[model samples]
Target chain A: MTNRRKFLRNLLSVTVALGLSKKLFPNLIAFDDYFDDDEFIIRNGWVLLKSDLDSTNDY
Target chain B: MIIDLDTATKNVKTADYDVCICGAGAAGITLAVYLARAGKKVALLEAGGFEYSDQSYDCYKGKNTGMEYWGLDTCRLRYLGGTTNHWSGRCKPLDEVDFMERDFFELPGWPIQKSDLANYEAEAKSVVDISGDFTAADISNWTSGKFIPDRYAISAPTRFGDKYRAEIEVSGNISLFINANLIDVRLNKELSSVTELVVMDYGKKRFTFTGKNIVIALGAIENARMLLNCDTQLKGGIGNQSDFVGRCFMEHYNINYGFFSGNPKYWKNMKKGLSLYTDSQFSLEHKIGNGNVSMSISPDPPTGGGRSKELRKYIRNNVCKWDEITELSRKFVDFQCPGDGILGTLMEQSPNKNSRVSLDKETDSFGLRRVNLSWQMNELDKRTIRTIGIELAKEFARQDYGRVQLASYILDENAKIPVGYHCHSIGTTRMSKSPEYGVVDKDCKVFGIDNLYIGGSSVFSTGGGTNPTFTIVELALRLAKHLS
Candidate 1:
């Protein structure tokens, strides 16, 4: 559980940084590393699956 | 005249007072003064002396069965001024929406509307030493559409014992008795009215007084304790035939919910403790209770700002891998953030039947039962706090004002909520249109009991997000007029 959380937290930071910087630097980075999977995304702080995020639109 | 129960018991005549009020705190003193000015003879009783003492405060000791809470003896003051002796003096009246019934909440709303108490605002302000308009347009303009400014008027925080001591001493119609604890209440044969009030001092010296009307102005917990302890006449307690005397106990849910990184320019000009509340429409749309967030600007911004602090808190509380922590730290170094501020919240807790005050088996020095406070919160309350954080974060992001990083407990539904209270005990003797719903009526009179009234936050139908002193004074003023 601990390792899984760490992996998720690192993924969240990278994803959030990419998402935020995407508007300013659209082509600065390629989306191939982790964006291949469309199921997982970060909203606010939680790492949610697309279906779960849609159901619990907390924000 | 102020009389010490120790030496002056001989001078106190036990007959024919127009009004007898228990607990010479804010409500008791307020009611006494107003009724005295209206030409009514009043007997005002104080369980404690002019100052603090261990003997007096020991009565407040009680058990907490449901939730972790501040020690009851320490949360409230027992002296003549009551808890106002140590209050921070933040004052705001309940909002209009606080009185209306909402589909999301289960309890019955206030019997009286905000407009009904508007007539006493001026007098209440005078009593608390607050002047000028409570809300500022400039503060309201700073917020986006989702939130609006909510102002709290600072008071000299009038100590009723000190502020009204001279007036009470000079009043010919008002008799102030210090160290007089109300131990027992005797009702008529029909149990329709309180016939006599039996008071005792620390020495166990007893005295009895009779009045045409009686007002129980003890603070919230004590008021309920008093009613529940007077079981000699009524089985369940006086005016408790419906078993509503000590139910629906409430307190303003105070906690630090999130952190904000606000715009430096806007933050510099704003007051350090300015509050912003969720707009009424937003609250209704979100199906959440009313909420207020007070900003406390950090004197020195942390190395990584509010987000870093939030992440650090989360990491400290939850199990996280070292590699993920290092990556999160590296991301923070890459992203420069503005100054951070802490967001302290005061959210309204929905009234729950289980949150209540009951009589404990253990007796105090005077043989009166101690309060057993079971402070409970439901799913609605938890949701309200979480929704307020989410809404605030979204609003800040929308306006470019800042970003809000919510506390970890707010993000996880299964996490235990940190227990916090504002010491604003309320709703134990709630008012309603009828006895089937509450202990008191619209006039603060006990249901089914004539000439017996309640004054203070105990009669509050709902504990809004704001402090209760202003409303307590307003209700006392309204009750005084009704009694007169």
Candidate 2:
């Protein structure tokens, strides 16, 4: 996987793995480079899955 | 009485005094007030007039080729009040750990201890117009091992000009000269003591003032420029013996590390550590670094309208719903916090030899070489910030306060480090026990020059993360007593 994608996957995994850790996402999205991206948007506790993905949530 | 050098008819003249102080800023004024009260004659030479003039401030303009910084002329004010005219008034004493020599930092120790300056600090609080009470109730056990109880006191940030103008006018012993810019320090043939201070005002009118003793109370950058420019008797500068005059420039590397929020109970525990006069502080036991790092948290909930208000209320009111918590987290997900608080870090840097101020060929209108400041950070600095941040993040998670998201820039080695000088310039003329290690000796006197001494943050051996004004006043008060 690409570095950006790999980074996003790891970030999402860490966010979930830590049981909705609040600090991680705030700091991650604080960066202007990733602030505009919509893939991480969450609605009703479910993250909007990024495109170009298979059914399984595996990197 | 305040004499305007610009208007004085007897411009080309010589005067004698017991003490000659350069730079009518915090240190100079503090020392003058104390010494004058003790019935000593003092000659206080201020470069600028009572108010700031463009021509006077232009002298501070310089070049910066090292780290990004505020223009040299911008950070410090060059008037009667000095930089205190624009000070933020945050006050905190240096921790005990800051005065000790740590193996992790180079030249990381002071010749004196906190106790040595304790009495002076008590007096300094009155000078800075802050409440003397600096006590804090520890709540570290609330998070078990997550935080240490650290606190800070606020200052009125006494402006020396407005606050002491009446006292200076009434003091019969102090000859306050406005616009009397110090141009040269003529030493005796042996170069042992400063014999005269050659000052010039606008219109090229010159005046000579001699004193039994001389104290350079100019701020860090100007102090180095003045010393480096005094190359008539000495090759490099006065007190440049051992080549330590302008080395080891230090400043607090302040940055927004990350943001985090705690549950209502967690917030309550944290709130107990903060007050109007004193605010939150943290320290780590068994730390690997030489300097103690202090971090402060600000509650920056969303602004604008009822949406932000509702969002905050929902996050504070609903703790159990995973969906609401995720939505609450998303608000702050992209640098925009829709949450309870924000976290910032103000870290101390180990003294680095390469970080220094040097003379450039470029001269200001006064023909004095402008100071070229080289501000560089070391690996220890980066490592300390990252390590402390990660440790804090882990502790919060373990204690269920909330997760900490460190700024991506802090984690990225190649990311352009954000640039913002806290206006706390320090350590150019660092103090030490011997000449080999520093520019000034134990009593704040220059190494080889007998009667020449230094006052201000320039004499700091280590630039602790705490704001420097409080310590500057404390040291100035101490130096006044020593001189008397």
Candidate 3:
């Protein structure tokens, strides 16, 4: 029962990550490719890119 | 020198002036200063005193028949400084395309070009207390070709009554008359020129002053009311030969049409109070009127204890672990975030003859008929608002800069568009090249009457998307130069 639960948990995490990637970046192809380039990072289950975190002080 | 017509000696009536300007508003005050500097004797008549009085303000009371609107007495002030006392002081020149004749519009374009008024930019800025340059560079990184950054110069809102009172009081050429209401406009025997203006005081004391030239500088609504009320000589009124006097009333249509969720970087970089205007090319291509969009940042609102129903249901059905639920809550909180900004729109109302001011049977203390305003909007005006929303939404999505969720009313064709006015009354006695189309000529002179002229937003040929006060001062300066 413990092993089965671990497998299910991993499957759910991957499914949620893929769903979020598709919704946030529709133009992007393949979640692994974007992850490899470190274009997007998941924090608290929300996708946060470098551009989003950078401060835009110039007005 | 300043003279209180109510207490002034009767001999003051015998004085004839070079110019008799009605209504001591921005236009009238500017005209008086410039014309006096040119060494012309002037009589500047203000219906109200230096300050507000209920008796004087009561003259502005009227009826509104079409569309929801603020009361006539509420929309405008009747005192010496005029509406400038309560103006926002946002100044921007009319766009060049606003002066061009678009084939799609029903009305004729302005007879004068934007260049004609460009010469008075400095003087206008001085009169309104706008310092530094009037132009601002576009956003360096904005890639959207459909929208461009528009700048507005905030003025100190120089109140004409307060700022220029001392100047007019001490000037030898300008005779500032307080509490002098224009009651009649007597014409020459040939009915080709204005001979004299009959003014009345609060106590119904009447006085007449004759001038070589006469100008009605009352605000748009009152200007029309005065013209339509002076029907003693002509059946319709003075300068109403074309029957276009009091027609085509316009106001800036202001409303909130959508909400924007901008990308964090661009949204944070946007200057507070920034305004985006539809590109002139976009307007021409879309066959729509000019529009201005402004965004205000707002805090995001949370619903259902900070988690959406969908997220709560997903977590419950998935039987997610404690750590997973915490992460999902934070993600869902960000995902269902409220709009980052509320998009407000201000657009020009296309000129329509039915949107007008006419005289009502009800009479004021002076025994003159009151005004009955019927403000209307057409399909083009409605379409302009909807198109701005749709186009902005599309552009924001395409550029990946933001997302726009339009108001349901804008998407529905049959839904009534909730609109409000900017209190910028314009275009009752429009300027046209020919008398058949409009009441005033390019020089702002009444077509058949050589000496009668008008100075105010009432003479606007096309009410552009920007505020009208700056243009009013510019036109007054031009008229002063012409008269001098």
Candidate 4:
């Protein structure tokens, strides 16, 4: 029971650390909301997922 | 001195010279300058005086039975500068492969190799006022590794009359005759050497000009016409013993087909590399089709808010609202509007014997028989163009540079290809090693004749995919050197 509690505490600590980093370096996760915009994905030099080109999420 | 035979005395005395060049075009004028500099007494004769006139241009009128062409009289100007007065000044050397025979192209290859003209290219450049080197490496090094190293440059389009007239007027050994038309090329009793040239002035006065050597430096059509009409002595033609004088007509074919869209990131670099009139070449390997293709990229103009019919049609078809598409166009970089952007093409026509010029019953003002030009193309031309288009599209997709949308005509083999010409008529008096294949020999001398020679693109064995003026000047310089 103590080991389980320690693992949960460690996982929560990493999550909080990442959350704090989001405020300091926003560019890393800034595009998490635009997975639907093909132009935005292409503009950022990322390949378009097949699902992005299709409307029904075929891929 | 530049003298007009039209103003000469009624009984003009016959003049004798070392070298008499008939037709003062690019080739004749260039040869005149070279020979005169070597201290040879040169006589340069031009059909027209200083500028164009309707009477001089009337001799160019003829029939075009096969392809749609610009009016015969409208295509080549017959003034003192010849057709260079209207030249666009695009100059590129013939590629090495163009001088060799390829099985894919019909009757391909030149009797004289590119190395034969190599020594004279620099002088040809100076003559044409091409100030820059045509090495592709000298251009932008930023192309996406797809362009072949076959670059071209422009010229100031040095009109020989405007540029060399002052020197020709002052040169003591050179004489320039204006409004002197070559009426006949009379040969000796043995029919081996040219005896004299019968020249007619504008006022109907005829005079003889005898020389040690004579050169027919007229343009392609006129060269064939002059030879074919000289049947008074030779039954067929002067060099028509083998009947190859007016065979194998060729020209550079250009068509506006296809669109290419590029990424906005490399838009600036791409524009710099593929600017207007910049020669960027690409060739296909054996696996695909061994043909060369060149392209010129241009920007699309803005079309929005009822400004374009295409946008209106798209709106009606629900492709997109005009405002939405316009906004999208503004958002994307280097987005090519339909019918805009890069034009990829193959300009070299396959040499065809059936595409020829023959004498018609019609006669010009000079009493010479008119030319019946049959400008024809074949299935190979269509197949080559389609293959080039497919290869270009594949390359663009493979390199991730852009997307190519080919025009419907390029995709459909049965599509009626337009017969419009690029105004580069070539290969009427093609050069060959044997008289069986061509009219002129490797040295551009008529096969059977001893003293007569031909100049201009008429002697081109195969018209490579570039302007012929630069090659014409190079060959003229080489011929002058040989004669000297």
Clashes of each: 0, 1, 0, 0
Better of 2 and 4 by DockQ: 2
* Overall lDDT per candidate, in order of appearance: 0.81, 0.73, 0.81, 0.73
Which rank order by DockQ, best down to worst?
A: 1, 2, 3, 4
User: For residues A20-44, what per-residue lDDT tens digits would candidate 2 score against the true structure?
Assistant: 5444444333333432454333222
Error (Å) of candidate 2 at residue B186 is: 1.0
Off by over 4 Å in 3: A1-59, B269-271, B299-339
i-RMSD of all predictions: 10.1, 10.9, 10.7, 13.6
- How far is B459's C-alpha from truth in model 1 (Å)? 0.7
Model 2 scores a TM of 0.80
Say which docking band candidate 2 falls in: incorrect
TM-scores for all candidates: the values are: 0.83, 0.80, 0.82, 0.79
Screening candidate 2 with a backbone cut-off below 3 angstroms (N, C-alpha, C), the clashing residue pairs are A23-B405
The whole-model C-alpha lDDT of candidate 2 against the native structure comes to 0.73
- Give the CA lDDT, 0 to 100, for residue B441 in model 2: 88
lDDT, candidate 4, B331-438, per-residue tens:
232234432346544366777788888898989777889988888886676765666665555554445445555554555566676544667878999998788888
Chain B, candidate 4: TM-score: 0.87
Q: Per-residue lDDT of B253-300 in model 3, one digit per residue for the tens?
A: 987664566777767656563478888899889888898888656543
A1-59 per-residue lDDT for model 3 (tens digits): 69999999999998988788558634333222223334443222223343544745211
Reference contacts reproduced by model 4? 0.00
Report the C-alpha lDDT of model 2 over B1-484, residue by residue, as the tens digit.
8888888988533477888999988899999988898888898888998787998988898888788887888899888878888888877888787787776676657999989999887789899888757655454444443345456677776888889889999899888888888888999988998888988887678888998999998899899889999997899999897787778888877766555545455465454333211112233243434222333343344345654666555554554246445545554542333343466456677778888989999887767898899998887777766666555655554554544555555656666566456878899899999888899987999999989999899999987767898899999999889888
